[model samples]
Structure formats: C-alpha cells, structure tokens
Target: MALSTNRSPQDTLKIAQVRSANVDGTWAIANKAGIAYSHDPVLGVSVVSKSDWGRLAEELSSSEFKMVKIDSVAASYGALQVWSVQTPRFDNARAQRRHSGLGAIWAVYSDEKSSVPDIQDFTEPVDAVYTWVDSSDPDWQTSYSQFKNSVPAAGSHPTSRDIARYTSRDELKYSLRSLEMNMPWIRQIYLVTAGQTPKWLDTSNTKIKVIDHAEIFESPEDCLPTFNSHAIETQISRISGLSEHFIYVNDDIFFGRPMSPNVFFTGSGSVKYSLAKAHYAEASNPRLAVNLAAKLNAELIEAKYGKTTARKFKHVAHPQRRSIHKLINKAFSAEVQETAKHKFRHVNDVSVPSALAHYVAAAEGVGVPADIDYAYVDLGGNHLPMNLYRLVRGRGMQMFCLNEVASVSENEKRGQLAKRVLDDLFPYKSSFEK
Candidate 1:
C-alpha cells in the first residue's frame, strides 16, 4: 500500500513490535489499529517472533496499511566500520559516553565480514541497530580489498597503517561482534541489505522485519543523499514506534567504554547541534582564505530574476611573501575591516545538516546562510587537513572529541574514539548538563 502523505494527528504511538518478539499478539493490535509493520534482516534482527514475522509478511502482503517505519541503526552502525579505514576500540568507557547523549544509536557497514567485537559489556540499552550490506556483485569485494590494502596517497596525514587496518573484513567482523553482543539492549535491528534475513537473529520472543533496501529509500537519488534523507524520514515515519530522538553513528569507532544518555539530551535548546571537526587554520591573513573560500563557494548564491548582482566581496591578494609578522598584521586588519553583515552566518555558526543543505542548495543557486542562529558543537576525527576542511565545509563540528578525557586509544599517535565517563571528560559547553 502507498504511504500516507498526510501526517498523523496523534502525538503518542505504540511500538507493536521491533524484533523477534511475540508478533501474533502485537499484530492483533496493529490489525485493529490498521497500522503497518517493518523489519531489517541483514543485520540479524527482528521486532517480532518467527511466527509473527511470517504473519507480518503475509498480512503486509495483503493489507493496505502495511506501511511501517524501520530504523536502520544496525546498518548504519556496521556501515561506519565497513566504510571507514580505522579500527575502533570496544570498551566500557566509550559506550557509556555515547549512550547518554543520543537516546538511540545504529551501526553502518558497506560490506560483510566474518568476526566482530563483543560490546554487550560496554554499551547502554538501545532502541535499535542498523546494518547495511552493499550489492552482491564481485566488484564490491575488489573495492573493499583495495581500500583495505591502500593508504592515503602522499600529502595525506592519517598514515598507511591506520587506513590499512580498517579496510579488511576481519576488522569489520570484530566490530560487528562487538555490536552483536550489545543486541539484547537494542529494541530492534534494521538490516538494509538484500536477500534473506539471517536465521540466527530470529526468535519466537523477538520480532523480525525484513524488507528490501528500496523500500526504505526510493531511487532517483544517489546513495549518500538517499541515506541522509531516509535516515531522517525513516525515523519520522516511525511515529508510533520510536522515541522522539534517535542516534546516528559511524561503525569503525567502537563502544570501547560505557555511556549515559543524559549527556546528549541534558541541554534544553530548541535545537542541539554537533559535528566532527574537519580542519583548522591559523593564518596571518584570515581574510584571504575565508574570502577566497567564500568567493569560490559563492557560486551557490542565487541572483533573483532581474535583480542586480553586486560585487559584494573583496579581500587582499599578495604576490610576494613578507615576514610572517607582517602577513599576520595585514590579514588581521583585513578580517576586521570586513563587516559582519557581509559574511555568511555559516562562517560563525553552523552544523552538519545545515552545512550540507547550504552547499547542496548552493550548488543549485539557492541562498546560503549569511546569518544563522543556533547552538553548534564540533565532532573532530580525521587524519588530513583537506578531509577536515571538507568536513567543516560540509557543516560538521571542527573539534568534536578534541578535549575528550577518556578515549579509546591514548597513544596520541593513534585515532580518537568516543569519550567515556570517569575515565576522562572533555570540556563541554556550559549549556551541556553536568
């Protein structure tokens, strides 16, 4: 049946079932309410029991109200590991840190693997897990292998070992194992892959829902964009099933520690913004790069029909280098000279979603944020300046975990992981609750 374009007026909704749970009774309720159902198979999870899964499949097949919202948390959780070139530490400290912030968390993966870490000991209770499996084609293997063996080409900062370590299926296995161990805490697991759902995940007590990836994300858009939109839409769609808020996470970074949900939801702003840091700059000529980046990025601005376009931007350009001190002085003056009114709000206040919308809209000649009003935080994890720059340009936090007190790897030479409590604490904004 087609999804309802109109929104439901009801504010409160019931979770009929999420995975391998007693489906018969719940469907009885769903049937009475004339609601839809959903599940994810690839990640080995279901919201209903085996009998209920069968019943749901048949009922959904014949019923017009089979529309249900599926959470792809597991898929996303795994995908993080599958896609990234890094290994995450699985410990209690990191797990608690993540749990307390966002009420829900999911794993994402780009491919399959044999072994994974055991995370039941680290993480808090979960609302759901999401798993994503790419296509069955052989080429995915080739790409995965290449990514596993390859290091960042020259000029890249993350180092060869970091990249190589996370490229293999074994690494993914370890991560998955960790995630699987956390299953009991998860309310449901969404598998975004094709083919049959794994059998071991099904049970008479849990509920399992399996549907094609296309069902969650309709085509006409590419994968990344589709994932972004579906990520939001899928949650919004689950008005009757999920809580008001959920979480999105990358998989390569494991739950090496314990976490509390209170930290993330503690603040009471109309909106909460967070992002990973991409890059940093300490130039003597602040106006030069900012102005240049802005100008180059300005192609995104739209000129209203028959409206006049002004030469609104200006900055200094030099051919020869003076002393660093002289450069700093000139740059500082230029930056001050440029009025706040002339610059884009994104330069001062921004977040990941807004940043993406800005540039994406910019590509289409739409207006960018010249003035923004919102709370923002940085989420930093990258090995290169360009990656960091792109992440910043994309609206991610520039220094998210920089001050984290308890991290997965403390070598300083190794990658960063989510922070934990008691282990260490990063200096959070005052707005964040203690």
Candidate 2:
C-alpha cells in the first residue's frame, strides 16, 4: 500500500525508512546495484552515485510506491531532483512540502557527500510555559468573585471582565496533545495555575510541572487571588528552573502540524517572533484593554528607541528568552511592577510576553521577524461553524487560536460547538493525560 497523506512529516519519514529497509533486504539493491548511502531521522537518505540513484528510483516505482518531485538542484557534477513518496489524498497535497529541509521521503545525490546545506539546526534545550486557570473550581471562583466585585465599573474596558475569557472548554488537554504529537522536542512544560489542576492531567509526567501562582509571583500576597492574565504573564520569567529559551503559550493556542525548533528559534539561539499585519498603533478602539495594552507597549518602545512599534504579534505561542525578559524587567521596572500589582486587567497594563518583550528583543537585535501559517478563529463571531470546518478539513496551518472575545448569552452552545471541533481535531489522549 501507499503512505497515508494524513500522517505527520515524522511519521512519513518513518514509513519511508521502513520501505527503504524492505527494498534493501528483499531486492538487495545495495549489493546488486552498487550504491553507498547513509540515513538519519532528520535527512532521510544520501545516495552517492547517479547510476545507483536511477536503479533505486526504478525499484521503488516498480514496487507500487508513489513518488513526486518536490525540489531539485543543479550541481557541477549533475542535476538532482528530491523525491517525496506519499499517496496524495487531496488535490493540492502534491504542492505541500512536508518538512523544512531536504526531502524526508528521499533525495538523490551527485557527489560523495550531501550537497544541500544544513538548515542551521540547534541542539539547545527549549521549554514551554502555559498560563491556565480553572474557573469552575469553587475556591478559584470564590477568589475570582471577591476580586472581580472590588473593581469599579466606570473605567474598566467593556470586555475586560468577560467570563468567556476564563471559561475553559478543556482546550488545554487537546493543546498538550497537539504539542506532544507535533513538538516532541520540547524539553519541559510548566503549567502555571491558581492552585487548580485538571482532573484528567497526569501530574506524574516528569516532563510537566504544575506551578502555582504563589510560587512565581514576586509578591504572593499582592498578586495571589488575581484573575488577570496580564498580571500572571508578567511573572512567567520567574518560573523556577525555566529554560533559557522558552515558548509562552496560552491554553487556547494549539499546534496544528509538525513543527521544528527552528520555527521558534534560530540556529544561533535567537528568538523568531511572528508578527501580524495588523498595526496596533493604528487601532480604532483604544478603550479596549488589549488595544490599550498594545498602545502602551508602543509608547515604551518609541520612548526608548525613538522608533514606533506598528505591527502587532500573532495570537500563537510566543517564543521568549529568560535573559531578555530580565532585561525588560530591569529596563521597565515600574511598568512591570504595575502590571503585576493590578488585580484585574487595567488600561495601564502592558502585555509583557506577548507584546512588550518582542519589541524590546527586536530593538536589542536578539529577535527577528518570522512568518508562520497561522489561523485565528473567534468563537463569538458568526462564522464559528465554518471556521472550525475549514480548520479541520484543510489541516495545513502551522498553528491556530480559538479565541472568545466576549461572554455571549449562548455561551453553553458555543462552548459545546468548540469542544466538538477540538475533539474531532484531536481524539487521541496524550501522555500528559491520565
């Protein structure tokens, strides 16, 4: 049979290896055809001779395997075409390159060694940090109600206290599943919460650590019962044992396909920040909490560097550095402290990891702009059903976010629809789950 198109790039490579091994064992192509090659998990195979490459291609096609030419290169020795062998399940599947580097399917060579230059892969350890809260928990709700009631209604943004923002439709469970399936290279995961853990999560997983709010906050007494995500995100760098390079993820964001560490970090360990086309500086609603935070961040950037921050960042996993965050804390000490002390989302707060840190890192020359195939699905929007359908059927995005802007009257209906889509997207249980 042919390789399934739905399989991930890593799984496709494994299947290719198995098929190659079978051809070597049964046909004895290496001995009869006189070919020398080496193979690895990253780069599939390297063929040294052109005649042997022709023979191998013939054997693979004759054995009922499908092959498509993905990329080609011309060298002084000869012309080479990279072949990816997989059954195309969709009309446009042939156009898609499964991996970032050379074909995971197979590649022919004209020289003694691989002519393709390495893609600057790094070996540094990377971690993931997620800020989550279980709003349904009695103790958490008690604190949330107490603090939420204390805030005055006159000056707060309309959607700042929206309950839809805190409602968890078990997105974290599937998000972790997506991470485990696609980004297996992550070294560790720190789940920051308000003294509540999901019942389905397996705390025994060594790769995951459940962090409490009191543990990371500089002043636990001041920030302990806070429901503000901005306040909590300000303390993410304070997570004990966090890696030098880490990705800050919100529970609503999910990895859609196989991803490499290079997607988030460069070979030299510089962070790659995904920028959106929307400019926060030109935003119409400055009264919105998120917009106000972006405007505040732009002010800081402009005051320090004299250059205006225009574009906003995508709503995906934010790649960050601990040292850079420390630098930001030192540079904007008062702003950082002010954000941390706010019990609720205030107009004066700055989005630290998502917005401010990216700008500061860019100014210091440690961060570079990158592009990702990202999708943002707003749950409160009218096209929720269509968006979810497209997200699942396409399966081409690198990352996606299911964001709820405000608490609608039909919260239960929308929650059910979103959960159904998530379950369809990821039905298999991850190791982090019991």
Candidate 3:
C-alpha cells in the first residue's frame, strides 16, 4: 500500500500530525466537509498523534463513538466544534488470511518460487470488454415494455429504476476511448450490448466488435427480451473471439490509468481477484441479486472447495479467464440457467463472476487473491462532484465507476461534470474512433 498527500510533511503534522501512521494492512476513509479522505491508505490503523485531535481519532475508532449514528456531535476544546460522520474501514488482513487457504490448494499441486515476474511486462495482448446499454433508446424502452407485465408494479424492482438498469450517459464510449489511450498493451475492445450501440462509437474500427445479446445467450428461449445481468454475464465466455484472458467491465466502469496484465495476473499465470469480505448472517434485501449471487459464490466455495471465504467482489472490471468461466458454467449449470431467465434482477440470481469463477481458478492453481484501489460515485450522491474529483484528480486512482445514472428527466449537470473530468483526463482521439 502506497500513501500520498498533497500537503508537505510539515503541513501534514500541523493539521492533525499523523504520528506513526499505520497503513500497512487495511486503510480507512471518512467524510469531512463532504470530501472523501482515506487514512494513510491501508487496513485497520490508528493515526497516533501528539495533538488533541489524536484522542478524537482513537475515540472514533472505539465502540463508544456514537456521534455518527445519531447525527449528533461532541467537542472538548475552547472553540465548540461539531462533527458527525461514520467512517469506512478497509481490512486487507482478511484477504491476506485467505492466501494460506489458497496456498495450501496451490502447494498440493506444484511449486516455482524463484524470481517474481510482472505479467504486464509480457507482450501478450489482452482485450477489454464491456456490457453497455442506453436506457432511453426507443428500442430498449420498447423492449422493457415487452416484459413490463412480468415485473411487479412496485417494490425494490421498481418500474422507474429497474426498467433502466443499463444507463447510457456516454460513459462507456469515453471509458473505451480512455482504455485505448492509456493502456498501450490493451488489445481488441469488445462492446457487448442488448443489440444497441452508442451513436458516437465508430463501428468501422476493426479493433472494436459489437457483440449482440442474441449471439451469446445459451438458449433461444432465454435469449431475447432478457434483462438479467447474471444471464448476460454468464455467457461472456461464449463470445466468438474473446481472448483467453480479458477484463469484463460494465458501461459505468472505467480504467483510471494504464494497467498491465501483471496487475491482474501474477507472473505465475494465475488470475487475480479483487475481493472484500462482505459476509452476512442473513440477507435482508431480497431483491439485491448481487448480494444473493455473492452468497451463492460463498456457499459453492465452502461446499465443493476446501476453504471458506465470505468475500464479495466489488463492482469493477475484473480479469477473467475464458476457460475458467466455462468450467464455472458447467459446474453450476442449473444455477446459471436459472439466473439466465431473470428478466430483471431477482433474489435467486447467482453472481459467479464476482468470486465463484475466480475462486475456482485459485482452487485449480491458477488464481491470486488481490486488493484493488478504485473510486466509485453514484450519480444521485450529494457529494458526487467531490467523489468525481477524487476519482480523476492526480491522486493516481487506477479504476473507477459512475453508477446509478440519472434519467433524461433528471439533471444533466452531473453528466456534464463527469464528462468534463474525463475530457480533461483523456483529451485526444483514440485510434478506435473514426
């Protein structure tokens, strides 16, 4: 974990004096004046300082810190100060702990521990793939109506929200252009959609391929009029010319900086999974299919595999092996088939892409457990501008996502803000463009 600050070392001490900042493992983050700040940057750590604020930091990490939950504040200085915020902690130890379990699986299989090689240094080309859709497209809007009667009138699967799971703010095209400009080694770019393409996209580019949903869906009965991501995701392996190794991203996701294959796969030819522990005793949101999918992944890993991991994969483009996904689909055909039929997100959906296939690759001695640093902003966020700044600014953010897209009826100012940042980041035209 690397820690960076815009302020000089002397200024860092003046503000709060991060004495013996512990960023070795998991890091931390908190909202201050609507700005997001992650601590020295790692897992579970307390910034020990000689200042009075040091005590406040310790108290906030302790069990008695209830100011954030109740939306109240407490002060101890002459000047009355009010602060109420719930901090988000990062724990890398839990992820590291799984290495032993993964190692045992690998150890029983083979051995090669000489020099560590960076896979990115290799010349083998890797492709970037994305599943994008524009909600406002008349064809798509009409398609949504085709299955409107199947969905309930109201609930978590709301008509106004679920009807447009795939929002097209032109983020995908910008993100694709960023991939072309930043990652020099990034090979063919694949755009998978529900039979829709961005108008701004250059279809004439041979380097780009627009894959239709009808081409990859397993069965004809479950192919058309499909609104389920699980069904769509499960069929990515079936893509005609998809590389043996590729990164799958949603239209909302992007590559913040140039990345090498080594960032994803280790020198040992093993794929890396960016995962976080998100196990729960029981799920409350029944309609949250991604959670259900993660739970399903956990259960599958525990039952068939030799280890137990309650980890959940974040919403980022992940390095996926074509064969590994095929194996996962074969091993869990029934679940995959059921997941495919969901016209919209449902509780029964399985998210094997998150952890299942990656975990299986590890069990078979071709996977690595890794942590990822990425910025994420929901369009509906009040501090979206700040989050977007944190994402594109010179903070060296590598990957990011802009989800929960605003409808046409909603304000387009958010879209403008995001575009401004992207335009500043990648101002040149990519070869993939006309």
Candidate 4:
C-alpha cells in the first residue's frame, strides 16, 4: 500500500504495525519467544523482556521494516534508550521502546503493576483558554472604529490596530479541532470573547464555555468594548472556576500532533516554557507593540529580581499558572491596571500571559526554559506557499502558529489560502463545533 506523503505521525505508526502483523504474525512470534509486550499510542507496541533483546531485534528486522536505536532525554527524569521499528520512507514515524528497567517508565507501564509516578508525568487538570475577536461583526466593527478614532495616531504601533490583527478565518474552529484531536487531556476550554460567540460553536458542549469580557475583568464598565488584546489578557486569570494550571492560546495557533502533559508541565507541576532565539533588546522594530511590551517586561523583571530578561517566548500555547498571574497582578498592580485601562493597543501596554507572565514565573523559580518542535508561518510572507507546503508534508511538529501581519486588503487576499490550508489539515469537526 502506498501511503500519502502528508501522513501524520500516528498514521506512520499504524502503517508500521500493519506491515509487522502481515510479515511476522503478532502472537506466533511473541508467544514463542515468551516476551511480554504492551501497546503504546506514540511508539506503537512496547515489548518488555528480562532476556537479551538480540534475538527479538533480529527477528523484527526484515525487508519490510528496519530496527533503529533512539536516545532520548526525559528532562528531569534522565536518559531513555529505545529501539524503533521504521519503514524506509517513514523513518520519522517509528514505534520505539526500551527495556523494562530503562531510565523513565513509559505511560504503557505506569498503568500496570508499577504504581509509582514517573518524574515526567503531570496528572493535574490543565485547561485551555483562548482570546478571540471577530472583526466582521457589525457591533464589534463599530466599537473598533470608535476606539480607533478615540486614540491618537502618534507613537502607536502600525500593526497594533490593523484589521489583520482581529481578522477571523474560522481559525478558532480548526484550532479547537486540533486541540480535541491532539490534546484530549485538556479538562475544559474557555473561549474569551467580546460578547460575541462563534455561530458554529456548540455552546451546549459541557467541555467548552464561552466567557465574555465582562465576566473576567474587575471593572467591566471601564474595560468593556476594549479592542486591545493585552487588556483582555491581563484579566484571563480572573475567569471563574479556572484551573490552577492552564494554557493560553491564540486563535491562530494550533496543535500539529499528539502531545503529553509533560510537554508543558513537570511532574511537580512546574511550567516548562519555550523561549525563542529572538530577543527584544535586539529588535529591529522596537516601536512595534509586541517588542515594546517585551522591552517593558525586561525592565519590570530587572526591577523586581535584578535580572534582565531579553529573550522572547515562542508564539505557541503558553503554559500559565493562575497563582503566578495573581502574583504578578498584585506585585505590579500599577502596571497591570495601566494595561487594562487601554481601550486599544497603546504604547504603555504590557503583554501578560504571552511574555510578562513567563519571565515572572521564571524569576520565582516555577518556570523552566524548554524547547519544542514548533513552526511559525507568516501569512503575509513571500514564502508562504513554501512554508505551508513544508508544514503539511512534515506532519511531525508539536505546535505551530499562522500569524497575519498584513493590511486589510492584503489579509483579505491571504485569508483564503490560510483557510484552505487549515481545512486540509483539520477536516474533522470537533465536539466544540455545531
């Protein structure tokens, strides 16, 4: 059978299993060898044996499949060694496993007789929060225009108020689809909006809740009709019944593949945040609101801990702690209030969850810098076609973001392409959708 080049990692693993079952009968070989094995979602089947692995390895290596060794680090858990079974073409998608006594215990083993928790496993309830706006709504557009005219044109970032920033291509729908497909462990999803809900969204779904700005902000009268994302983000932690641990995601960000809780949090409930190589201190466009917020965040960190923060966090799903947000809100009451007061993106605004919260959490020794398999595609970039092609062909990324930084006319043209790409990536509708 010829597999499509754009197959997901799970698809690759399934293909490997079918070939193995056909070439080497599953029970005949394993039962004769007297080896115990279990099924792993990511690594296919994991066989644990007290005897030497030489015979099993040789028996599995055939013309259809090849066995390769993998060395992986389990962050705080130490080193992990596993042998992977892969096809020649789909080498990136492999079924792998190590001995029973290997470094860290796999999830497949954690369920069995071993009741001890793995150092990498995080069992706490983690929710997902998304801040979204629909610029096409007549009421929203009227409010946006009113706020845009109210603010002075000088000193404000060009793209801060750009319609591209608020444009919706049904990206939120696909993002939720990706979440349900890839990260099923999420306990609940809160869609924070400006009193507008997606028409296609299934509000009756118990897993999802729609939260208006009035519900989260302390002073809804002053902050309502706000077009500023920074302002909205500052009060996300105020959501009623929000979990202690949560991930803040933008409407354009997506989960590309299956992920474990360990990717965001440690066994001890500490956050693992991904940092980008880009730093605000070296920003080419310091006037941009995002970079300016980073610079302001650096200053705040410097003032609080005597340590300077220069690097920016990645545009992926940010792991956030409600307690940390409350801490920042109290510690920097003036700054946080100032941010909330902005009716639109202003020069004085500071990003809370995206940038500031990570730095503050790190300074308090609860957030650790980490790495992720991520990709960022600029919707307005010249190489958009190539970037999206690579994204689809290599369906191995953990997370990705499709950001539009173009003008209204430019975004209108690019929006179609983005929708097509999203539709191709996520064809199935999630329960959150109608």
Which has the greatest lDDT? 2
Per-residue lDDT of 1-434 in model 1, one digit per residue for the tens? 12122443111111111111223433454466554433333333223323334444455435432222222332232223210001111113332232212111222322333223233211222333233434233554454455434523332222212322222221222223333322333344343333334333332334324444445432213322121211322222222343223333222323322122221222220112232233213334434323333332233223212221222211100001112112222333232222111211123211112222223322334222221111121223344334333322332211121221123243533333222211122111111011
Please write out the lDDT profile of model 2 over residues 173-240, one tens digit for every residue.
97897776456668899999988889988899899999999999999887677878999999999999
TM-score per prediction, in order, is 0.28, 0.78, 0.67, 0.78
Candidate 1 displacement at residue 235 in angstroms: 9.5
Clashes per candidate (backbone, < 3 Å): 98, 0, 7, 0
What is the clash count of model 2?
A: 0
Pairs of colliding residues, candidate 2: none
lDDT tens digits, residue span 1-434, model 4: 44344765333433223334432443344457765655433322343433424455555454444544432322112223344343444333322221111111222221234323356667788999999888899988888888789878765666777776777888899888777655666888999999989998888999899999999999888777788899999999999999999999998898876465778987878889999998787888888888889888888889989999878888999999999999999989999998897877888888999999899888888899989989998888878888887766763467899987664363565667778777666655677766
- Maximum-TM-score candidate: 2
> Which regions of candidate 4 fall more than 4 Å away from where they truly are?
1-116, 152-155, 411-413
Please give the range of 10 consecutive residues that has the lowest summed lDDT in model 4: 95-104
* CA RMSD (A), model 1: 21.4
**Residue 65 lDDT, candidate 2, scale 0-100:** 43
Better by TM-score, candidate 4 or 1: 4
In model 2, state the lDDT of residue 78.
26
